[model samples]
Target: MPCAMAIWRVYLLPLLLLVLLRAFTSLPTQAAARGGADPSSGTDDGKHGSFSRNLLQDKPEITEEMTRGYMSNSELEIAVQDFGRRCANVSRVYSIGKSVNGSPLWVVEISDKPGKREAEPAFKFIGNVHGDEPVGREVLMQLAYWLCDNYLKDPLATLIVENTHLHILPTMNPDGFALRRRGNANNIDLNRDFPDQFFPINDDINYRQPETRAIMSWIKQEHFTASAALHGGALVANYPWDGSRDKRKQYYGCPDDKAFRYMASVYSQSHYNMSLSKEFRGGITNGALWYPIYGGMQDWNYIHGGCFELTLEISDVKWPKASELLVIWKQNKMSMLNLVASLVKTGVHGRIFAADTGRPIPGSLMVKGIDSKISASRTFGDYHRILAPGESYEVVASMEGFTPKRTRIMLERESMNLDFILDPDGAAGQTKRLPRDDCGCSCDDDGKPFLIREAYLWLYLLVVFFLLVLYLLFRRRISSRLARNPPKRPVAV
Candidate 1:
């Protein structure tokens, strides 16, 4: 009996060792499957390290008449051509240049009124500046398809295409995209390659790549009103000019600083779940250079071209899976439409004052003509509002001391300028009010004030609560596991 028990123990010990070995060996594969780190590469164990694998293995094939989340260089080319063919009335494809590897750099222009392209202000969207950050390319491609397909059905889409010229270069670095490398075929970072008239290029970074030169030339010729370059690895919309550092060599603010703030705020409000007015409190950091980067696309666009350019880092993960593309598309599509549509027409500026006291009244003013919307201006004297063109509309100004002023105006033309002065009795009196309809006339759809969307606010709160609950559950599980398997003690000192 003793001999048989010994034999059983010996066999069981080897079986247990074999099972442990298999489990240890499978850890890397399991991690990769969960979108985690690659054990083979001794790098940081996170989304960044395994981004390429996720991109390559998970993306689906592109198809015509249907939107796809993932695509390769050749697949994307075919998809773009198909989109052009399907939406021949509203879209056109143009070749900007060729990559170093002889791949064509394609731009898909989407506009409802194709013949009226030259007359309108163009807004360019480029993606995949870093080869590994492919989410932008997918998102832009999806947007192009959406804009072209839904032109007649969707009011916002129709409005944008009818008013503005949207130029989308889905892949800026085809060679790098093909190779899945951060740098182009020539091993140059395209974002840093723009011509710096003041700061000359040096060996620390190479800024004279062919792709960058082509982009600069295009910008000079196109005179785009606003542009956005999309990237990944960080989830924030960064704006220019990004080359400045403060007295401590810490990343600081850009020049033309106010414009940067305005544009960044616009982007955050339109897309991310954060306040546009504040910086870095929620959502993502804005304006301030929290990271050190030089010769980026946004800085070049703002400084040289005098255009409002933004760099939208779409996801915290380096290369998000094809499945995650749709979520990103939903978040960015409206913002993209808003940015382009806002540029088609300009804003109207005016001042409000008390008719009785002849003093400026500061308060909230609502402009409802082309579009029913409200805008607030510095109440002390001047107020500026932006609205679209149509015909009959009303402008109402309200304050505590002054009676709410309401006036009717007709904007038959494309742009109109008008002014107003409010009487104590909420009537338009005989005072030469500044033109309220000045500047270019365009509709302002800033959406319901943050308070009115109570349902959305509650939904957001619920999501936060759920996430907190999940975190606590995960923390407890980890704690219990640690307690059950405490670390083994070392030998006596």
Candidate 2:
């Protein structure tokens, strides 16, 4: 009996260990074979094609059966135009540009004063970056409709419409959506089409895809305070420095890292199940920390457009059933609203104007210690500087001709209004008045011009005296010069 027991322990345990190892190793192959999501994937450029990790495993490949009830491109266009007509008072529909297949990239600008530049922060939502990810496009359309239907009736909706210019691009890549693929008509990933900070893939202007060009142009035309591009196949809010400097997959954070983390948290904490995610802690991640991808839209918006942007992976499934879209919207509703409201509810918003002229000046805004700078709009001089609350900051506003003003504020939980009326650096110096109103709310009143008048009087007198002295000197010098060297007489007529 003792001999039999020893033999059983050795043989059975060894067999079991071998079988377990084989089963664990076969999991990926089994997943691939079942047409289920496998982490293995390749890029449109055909690089990194099979290095998908467990975290990146997607839903089974999208099929026609899955997209049966989804809106077609023609139907989407009609819907957008219809939305414009129904909500014309708070919305305007316009085309940013066309897709590769010449499908108009329709944008719904929602604001109390649509198509006008007011002293307000602008936010944009771009959906359908990937052709296969139809969830974002549908959900974004739902967002627009909700805002239209709830405006004035809902407090949050009313706040957004009256105080913010919200731009909704329901689909950025219609050709990709129609094809039901991961890329555009030319098969280029629109997300990777932007010029990367570390790579030269899209440096040449002419070489960019039409969809990428349109977005680049649109950002240039509008001074968006913040923007987000919606995506799926994951559920997390991603923030910038999408790639590391060394081209390694590591946590590469941008200058506004803290502020971005706060913004991302605002979305995750507001969501129903996002904060409960077991994969990503707190449902937020730095772009490079997740997986280093260059030429991404989020990083470009932050770096070039002065727009603080987030890449939102709002769904775990890339192509969810059409019926599931409404539920998805309901889950992400508060997140979307809170994110837009952050522009007005948590930021330092104000206009920069010339004190003497009272005209809006296109100025750049910078926090005292932070390296990054956001610019005010050229039309309205309005700038929105979103920051984490409960901290003191020295907000600096500067224009080329105006004296840069720096004022410190103890920002509480709510947003603070800090309008800066900068005097011309030249004017302040010429007047020599009281260190140029370098402190709090001094420009609120031009009530007393007496000091300016006194300074001007002295300046005028000094200029006149100098000019009279110069004239006498010139007379004396001319008389002496004529004695030394006679002036040439008119010789030829």
Per-candidate clashes come to 15, 3
- Stretches of candidate 1 exceeding 4 Å from the true structure: 1-69, 115-118, 202-207, 245-255, 272-279, 282-288, 345-493
Best by TM-score: 2
177-245: candidate 1 lDDT, tens digit per residue: 776677789866776565432344342223356677678777765646578888886556676545443
Poorest 10 consecutive residues by lDDT, candidate 1 = 42-51
Candidate 2 lDDT score at position 124: 98
Per-residue lDDT of model 2, residues 140-243, tens digit only: 99999999999989999999999999999989989988888877999878887776656553346777789989998898888888999999988999998787
How displaced is residue 237 in candidate 2, in Å? Answer: 0.4
Q: lDDT of each structure?
A: 0.60, 0.80
Quote model 1's TM-score: 0.55
